[model samples]
Target: MSSIAIKFGIGKSTVSDIVKSKAKLEEFQTEIDDGDCTKKPRVVRKSDFPELDRAVYLWFVHQRCKGTPISGPLLSAKALQLYPRLYPDNPADFKAGTGWLRRFKDRHGVRCLSLQGESLSAAMMDVEPFREKFLKLVEEQGLTRHQMFNCDESGLYWKLMPNKTLVTSREKEAKAFKKPKDRVTIMACANASGSIKLPLLFIHKALNPRCFKHIDKNDLPVHYYAQKSSWMDSYIFKEWFLNRFVPLCRNALREKGLPERALLVLDNSPAHPDIVSNIYRWIDNMSLLATQHYIRYPTHGSGCS
Candidate 1:
């Protein structure tokens, strides 16, 4: 053993350790050969409840494939939800807490990271100044929580499909299929106090979908509009603001005996009409108190609204 260690340029203790771990090393090699393991991790730590952990992992993977954002709390909640079903007979004390979550992440090689955008590049210095200014303006204008509103639009990929899948060694290749690119933009608005939630503005590419052929557009729950790109534009926003939003606010205020005036807080979106120009003077003309524009600071990184 000493001569062999010297020949291989290894310490005698290392050779003895390797001899001791020979069986485990062989078993690991067998696992890699059989395609059960990828040889990424040196040690394989078995879970107490393998089936339960696997179910949670599958659920997590499914959600991720559908582009659903997952957080630590959500994962833990899901584990707790599925635990009872997986181990019906076993009355084990299983709490999916922080420790379990940490182990689960390590076991599945999962890491939390920002997949798309660089939010850290935002000018954080401007944030405090903006908050101060906004608060001061609200105080000076005597804008109550219910009288102030904020609106934003987000896209929903309704026809999203997973781009990746696990395949067996027997299969030559996994066939690719054209994924559906259907999407819609939904615009939602609500007051700071959550007292007033305006009807959603739903935008689609088609003017009249086949499903809604027999139905009346007027009876729809949302303020529906059509755009070629199925996205918010200046024309669509202006129409919704004047026809839908203004009327709804006016009626709600009348019912509650509040003042007709309201302060609409809007982010600097391209779809929003240029406030600097005289094009969108309806805020003042139509008895709406003011349009508070949240401008993104011009910086090296793209500003967030």
Candidate 2:
């Protein structure tokens, strides 16, 4: 080893390892009865200990589903936490470190990903289908660009994004959302002609918050409503449509000097009470309003962003 190391200008330990590699490399090659051992196949295993890795993966998925905050270091710490409990025989002798973490991530295909729930890719596939339906509806209703209106309810975090919004696949934990966050639901209605914009409804959990102590409620940017969870429901939707939306449309059309005939595009959901069950009642009530509009329902997330 010393002679080989001096001649190759390498360390004696490296020369010894090189000499030992010949048998190890040969062992990795295929052995056939035909005396041919040319192939060297790459093998994939779940982990050095696949059964233990499987348990870890299951635990990871369960915790993630519960919206637990997880990071690389956190996962490594967890592995250490579970090592003794999982392997009772010589548990303290187990090696759970960067090597295990790296292999575990690769095996499970878990990555640190920033997941935003918007940008519904599944909806994009139906854009062409929606266009054809939209055109057919417009022709049936005899509606123009000035008469076309859109209303959508969106979820927002006034303070910061919620930690539950972040998601990941496989045996790793999701990254927690940073910053303080308070959720708010907002509903808005506007015309394509940009002439009419009805009062935007901002849903809050509290009827009166400490933050609004100084600001006048009458001069607020949006019409405020309160609910236990600050969410829109069938009752609120009916009131907005019959009492608020109907009057706003009539006034807006009158201001623009356009005919009181328009289409109200709705954000549709199959399970929703307002857009599904109580929609017929709303349509019947529209006859009393000065503005005669038809309800144009688009599937959940199928509407234009």
Candidate 3:
């Protein structure tokens, strides 16, 4: 062993360790493909529950192929669920906790990443032409940073529960409860310069929820409204535009000693009405005191930066 270590330009202890692990190295060589024998890893750790590990890894791969997201807790839960079925007669005490999950991921060479959706899709789309056109329009209209604004709405699950939880050793399974579906819609508007932010328009299913029964709706921080679906609609948006938006914008401009003339950027949502395509006609009928121009921005693109 000493002669072999000297020939390989290594320490004698290293050769001794390799000699001790000869059986394991042979086992690894047999497990991998013939072509991959030359690409063997330096270290190979065996799983405590081999069948369970394999089953979990196969299940994870199947889910990922179907575009299903797998969280750490979800993976752990699935492992715990499958263990009993895999070993009905065995008395193995398996708790697929965080430590076990870490090792499992290392064994399978798995990585956790954020799911890509609309934002990533939008990034891939060509928005440069739209940006150039928008810049040109801004320059032609003599619009300042403070005079350009953008508005958008989003849904909120107010009473959503956490995806994970903790349980005692005495309790083998975590308690399950009906997930809440309580929701609301919120709309926000702000200028490019960040000089002004209008009051949020909050929409709920109830005109006066039980929590706000004793309080006046007008006194609330948000400009509250009620709709059956708790979603933004044409009527609600029109009301917000004519009543809330115009007056607030006029006041804001007055305070800044600027003309009550500005441009509003919006998306092509059904709720925004037909003003985007024919804003001049709509503005004429509304007979507003201030001049307001509306621009229909691409929905896939983000808000004005």
Best by TM-score: 3
Worst 10 residues of 3 by lDDT: 284-293
What's the lDDT for all of these models?
A: 0.76, 0.65, 0.75
lDDT of 3 at 262: 69
Give one digit per residue, the lDDT tens place, for model 1 in 192-239. Answer: 889889989999999999999999998999989999999999999989
Give the best candidate by lDDT.
1
Point out where model 3 deviates above 4 Å: 1-109, 114-117, 123-126, 168-171, 277-305
Quote the lDDT for 147 in model 2: 77
- Cα displacement (Å) at residue 107, model 2: 20
lDDT of 2 at 76: 74
lDDT, model 1, position 12? 96
Model 1 scores a TM of 0.54
Worst 10 residues of 2 by lDDT: 285-294
Model 1 poorest 10 in a row by lDDT: 296-305
